[model samples]
Target: MLVINALLRGGIPFIIMGGIALLLNYQEKYSDAKSTFFASLIVFFVGAATVIYNIDHWSLTKQSVVHFLIMLITVYPILLLSGWFTIASVFDALKVFLVFVLVGVILWIVMFILAKVFSW
Candidate 1:
């Protein structure tokens, strides 16, 4: 879950998809340990960068356009890596977009519920 969130926030789904492709292409030559370690490191850096950026840019008031723009910037690479640029890949793009939206909604709902329950 953290990895997925990190990938979403970092706009680095291509890195993850590429790593998966590499693993599948050379499963016999590469050990799971190496792949996992490298992937974890990449995710760590990406997640850290996202946190830093958010911390520096956060504002009390909401701006829908800014939020949308940030989301678009984060999602473009993932869309490209998922092959969403081709006519045949329109469904793929929709799927990825839905998944992202669903995950975000779920996270928000969970946070809201938890806050209510805990009085936070």
Candidate 2:
């Protein structure tokens, strides 16, 4: 039941990312099989991590923090190794990290607002 729900949740992003990876490969943007594999894996982690939100007992803050940590640990390395983003210096790495955080916050806010409006 729960497992099936989680699988369904994760499967969408997995398929989407797989397609994107294939497209990138076809276009010769990132032809490395290893990079494609890692890119797909990153999306899997991201999609699966959404299960955290289903934890009703957890506060929103707790859920967001846990999800953020999960993504940072699981997705950051793959993005770097897959040639999605290059960080030639510490400053560049910091800039990338900041941009990641900013995007996450903006997306979170948008989703939160949509959820509230829809629930109302």
Cα misplacement distance, residue 74 of candidate 1 (Å): 2.2
- Candidate 2 lDDT over 72-116, as tens digits, reads 987766666666677798887777778778988998899899989
Best by lDDT: 2
Candidate 1 at residue 27, lDDT? 64
Model 1: lDDT of residue 18? 54
Q: Per-residue lDDT tens digits of candidate 1, residues 13-84?
A: 546655675776576644553445444443444453444324335662343344444555655444445332
Write down the worst ten-residue block by lDDT for model 1.
60-69
Which pairs of residues have clashing backbones in candidate 2? none
How close is every model to the real structure, measured as TM-score?
0.39, 0.76
Alpha-carbon local distance difference test for all models? 0.52, 0.78
Off by over 4 Å in 2: 1-3, 23-40
